[model samples]
Target: MNNKTAIVTGASAGIGKATAIYLHKQGYKVFAGARRIDHMQDLVQQGIEAHALDVTSPESNQAFVDFVLANSNSIDVIVNSAGFSMQGALEDVAPKDAKSQFDVNVFGLMNITQLVLPTMRAQHSGKIVNISSIGGQMYSPLAGWHYASKHALEAVSDTLRMEVKRFGIDVIIIEPSGTKTEWAGIAMKTLLEQTPKDSAYRDIVEAYADGSFDGFSDTPEQIGELIYKAINAPKPKTRYQPSFSAKMMVIAARKLSYKAFDRRLFKQFRAMISK
Candidate 1:
């Protein structure tokens, strides 16, 4: 029997929930957490341990780590999938809102990882799977803060990878593009609410909202499978792009000149909002 334990944050829905379930199926004891404890009853019913976790709170993070360790002796994997996008024009977003974004996306992840490291380091093996977005590599208008947070995550993850490698912990990043989840709707709603009615960015925000994500998105289950594949590898790559388009976009962002990439990206953004 495959006996491993995995911790998945943001397990109330979307990628985190899917990953928790997938890991369970693969014979790992899954401990899933999110603020929405009610939303995770389904996970509980399926034999995954679900707990209430406020990632932003250090107390909550410590408690979560304690609970998981109480149940399982070792934490073999930790998938940090608890993040949300704060979308709006940079000028329109309040500093507090931007800080909140960083709190959840960057600080929370870091905090949780810190709590788990002692256990992993003692065991001499563990996997840290961070669910980053292609936005970490590329950018769009009106999503400055969101992109910034992801960019920060990318840098932190890179540094952490080096820091933990000596201890036998693998830090892996999953950069998915659009996914079939409530995230898009929530992001759009936040964008509209954050932008003032008479704001100059209204047209762009509205148009961006109208654009459909059907063909461009992957299902949460697909990304979950990718995560499974990545962590299971004896020597996993530092980064995994779950979709072809996401890989291509990351390549473009890395290879193209700044101006060229910006122009190309803006053209696509214009097309998206124009439609």
Candidate 2:
């Protein structure tokens, strides 16, 4: 055993679960937490510690952190992956729901990070990997709130990276595209739920729902591998786009003018609905 400790949130399923397993295989003492404790039985059987965690709940976050600290001497890594995508036209999505998106993706993540920073600062070494999305770099229809949250996360990660460097803590962002997981289904559900049947944007929203954006979908394991690479690297890049399409989208967003990107995006949306 490496005896190095790692904390993984949202470990009941999807990329978070896969990441916890990968870290375990890499010999880190992994403590995995999620709201669904039953879903983590397999992790426990694999010698990983599993606990119930709701990132939005401060008490739960505190308890999870304490649990890990009581068992391990040091926190070497923390992969904050407990987030979901909410999709709908900005006007159509309920304001409260939009706030919930930010709560989980931005504020909740910061809450957990604040809890771990003291330990990392004292140890003078740690890795903070945030699982963002390609949407963080580019925008799309029916997902304004979700994209905004990711954009916020990206900006926060960048600022935190500079702030924590003095204490030897590295904040890294991972931008993944269409990773095969339950996230897509949940996002689609939100798209439909947020937009009414008689809504003017219904046609375009339905078109987006019917389409398959996962033609080149990556597996959760693949993303887990990328997370491992970032954590293990001596000097990892601040941002990582795990897939070719993600990298291209980020580059396009950076190189193209806002109006140009909008024209291209709308053109694609037009095509999607026409078919």
Candidate 3:
């Protein structure tokens, strides 16, 4: 991977930040992209090229792509890690909020991938790693919109992998369980914002939010290492369910029917509320 150029969105913090640092350590010329460029100043100090990218904005995405193409001539890897959760019941989430979630998680990811594909195809070798969530495969009632976005991403990534194989470009999905990042804190805040004190789902939402905040979430570095492995591997897999529980949950969801899965999910939610 040495001397290769990589563009990692959401590189200001959390998994994106860790991944950028990890890639840099592995000798890749990393282009760390985030909305808050100042937040990535540390990455610049560490020799990673930092770019301002608001994935939700088409102009920003295009500008970043143009910048990369002008400077590096080719992008070896593109990691779409720019996304967030807007947690709440489906009925409670505002339409605008739901659309915004899809704008970032789905449209933004797709835009960046489309921009990078031409270069990857020309090179005949490149990797695209999309950071999705375990919630994509196994839904949590508390994070309805977030789960829906990830599910969409899961499908898109799967489809892209098959379509891009002929071009020698690989599309890999990274499904992480609850990782120790600001993601849960932000999700909890969104949950409280959408759920009023008297709402029917308030207690359940609070319980799930609290549990997520207190859970043994995996470290961002763990995900970073997994991403690094995917980038370096001779033949990367289609999907990497990283965390222990994440992999197990996907397995369980696959084995169980819909009714069984719903029952188990409800039981788990009820137990959390009871605690």
Candidate 4:
């Protein structure tokens, strides 16, 4: 036993899976969670214990924490990487889906965090890293609800960081720009399937689906490395944006006025849709 046990949600694939692998290599006992049991066979083969979890369910959250506790006394770290993003025009998005997005990305994250608090508090040391997107800080057309969930997560992380400081527990947020993952494809497909086909915004939606969207070279393993760094830091920062493009976007968002940022983004999308 490494004596350090970490739980990583969203471990089925992408960033979450990568983080689990990286953390295990770093010598921590890794416990991974996701809704897709079949998808986590790779994690299990790597020797990381995999649990079926739904972040939105309180019962599921409790069971996950309990299982970890039964096997280990200390809960050293947890990365709330489970998330969802359904892209569509705001007016066309189903209200239930919008709420569901936040339920998983925001409130569901809180559910696990709250469940782990007592254990972490008892230990007087723990780290909670939230996987947020750069989209939280910057917005794009046809992705309003996705952005809103991330924005809500950022606010929650900020407030939790302050509250948990005295408990010797650290809260960190990871803001990724673009990564080589299926997330974009999934989001793009959702946009097309869920949005009204006749909506005038179909042009940009198809533009996204056809892959004219601005893409990046960032990979899930890179995000894993960043999360590993944040976990190991003696004093971790509240926010870590690992990708250079992510850093630039964050800087621009901070430096430019909202109107300026909107104009720049609008021009880019306009050109793409027109093409």
Candidate 5:
């Protein structure tokens, strides 16, 4: 087993947890950070170090990095997987809620990324993987805040990639289409909570939570495997679309004209709410 160490954020459950366990199984020393330390008992039993980390807090993020450096001496890979979806109409979403979404999905991600950059750049050989989503590229009915955060993430990852390439650190973006995780359910709950019943967007929000849309949803384990693959690659690609049909969607979204895409999206949402 190799001694190379990797840190995974959002490690208590879902994609982060899955990726940490998989990397550990494959011979890397793994350190996982999440808010819920109680949920990481299994990782601890398997020799993976798990720590409590509130990604929004700089102190918490710094401490997690310090702990990893103290134990492993070097960090070879970092998978930024801590995130959530905050779905709402642009006009309907509260300002505080909108700020909170960016706090977790965009700014919080950068908080941890900043902590690891000095280590990676100093090593002159490391990998940084950012978990983006299909929302980064495409737009939908009522998920304005969630999509905007991901879009910002995409820009941030792209900029980081260009800035860090000189240091031999590879920056990669993983965009998953529909993955079976708490993300969707949490987004649905947010929609129900924020959008008022009398709001014009209410019908569409209800349709979203009802799962009226159909698409491929990969398992968390599946996405985990992809992240592991990215870490192991000697020369990883700039971006990877891993979910079933995700690449197709990304390509289609890019190719379609603005009006064309809007027509299709409007039709889909209208159909969903009509039922």
Candidate 6:
């Protein structure tokens, strides 16, 4: 790992932060990117380089790539982890809200990946790790728009992996279950505001919001560890399902017919709300 240079987006907190610190400890030249530079002060003190990056902006993405390439000559790994969730039914979600989710989770990730690809290709070797969610594969009754964005990401990552393999650049996807992050709290708040009682999906929104308020999310570090393995493994798998529940959920979704899956999901939603 010491022989490589890694650029981790969203490195200020949660899984991104954990992965950055872990890479640095393993002797890699780690560049941590996030909007809040202060959150990465601790990393700088430990010899990791921190950069302010807003992945939604093309200028910011290009600038980050330029800075890293100029300083290090090459980047061996890139982790795209700058994303958030906004929960609500599709009808309850405003167009602006849905667009905003895609702007950050999908477009922003693509911007950075494209910016870094030229350099990676020049080096003839690189790895791109995209942090998707279990929500990407299976729909969440509450987070419809957010799930749409992740589902789009799944397609993007799949296509990119195939497209870049010939370049010796491996693209890996990390699918995490409900990990414990500030994301859920923020998502729940948005759900309430965006899907008020007057909305058609109010009942489902309320049910999901209540469930999110209760404790059901996993820690971000679990995803971080899975990400670390994806980066360092000699022959990394194309897709990694990090959380145990996340894995099971994907399996269950796949095993069940669409009607059965919908029935089970709705039942789970009712159970959550009753509690």
lDDT values, one for every candidate:
0.92, 0.92, 0.88, 0.90, 0.87, 0.85
Clashes of 1: 0
Taking the tens digit of each residue's C-alpha lDDT, what string does model 1 give over 119-194? 9999999999999998898887888998999999999999999999999999999999989888888888878888
Writing each residue's lDDT as its tens digit, candidate 6 over 1-275 gives 46789999999988898888887877789989999999999999999989999999999998988888888978999989899677777766778878988999999999999999988998899999998988888885767788889999999999998899999999999988767777777778877887666887777677777765565556676666777788779999988997677789999878989999999987887786676
Instruction: Point out where model 2 deviates above 4 Å.
Output: none
For candidate 4, report its TM-score. Answer: 0.97
| Minimal lDDT window, size 10, model 4 | 207-216
Tens digit per residue, CA lDDT, model 3, 31-110: 88999899999999999889999998889999999988888977999989999778888878889999988999999999
Which pairs in model 1 have colliding backbones? none
lDDT of 1 at 69: 91
Better of 2 and 5 by TM-score: 2
Order of models, best TM-score first: 2, 1, 4, 3, 5, 6
Model 2 per-residue lDDT at 14: 95
* Alpha-carbon deviation at 156 in model 1, angstroms: 0.9
TM-score of each: 0.97, 0.98, 0.97, 0.97, 0.96, 0.94
lDDT of 5: 0.87
> What ordering of candidates by lDDT runs from best to worst?
1, 2, 4, 3, 5, 6
Clash totals in order: 0, 0, 0, 0, 0, 1
- Angstrom error of the Cα, residue 68, model 6: value is 0.7
* Better structure of 1 and 4 per lDDT: 1
Q: Look at candidate 1 and tell me the lDDT of residue 104.
A: 94
TM-score of 6: 0.94
lDDT of 4 by residue, 1-275 (tens): 46799999999989999999999998899999999979999888988999999999999999999999998879999999999987888988899999999999999999999999898999899999999998878887778999999999999999999999899999999999888888877777777888777898778888767764466778999999999999889999989998787899999888999999999988878877777
Pairing residues by index, what is the TM-score of model 5? 0.96
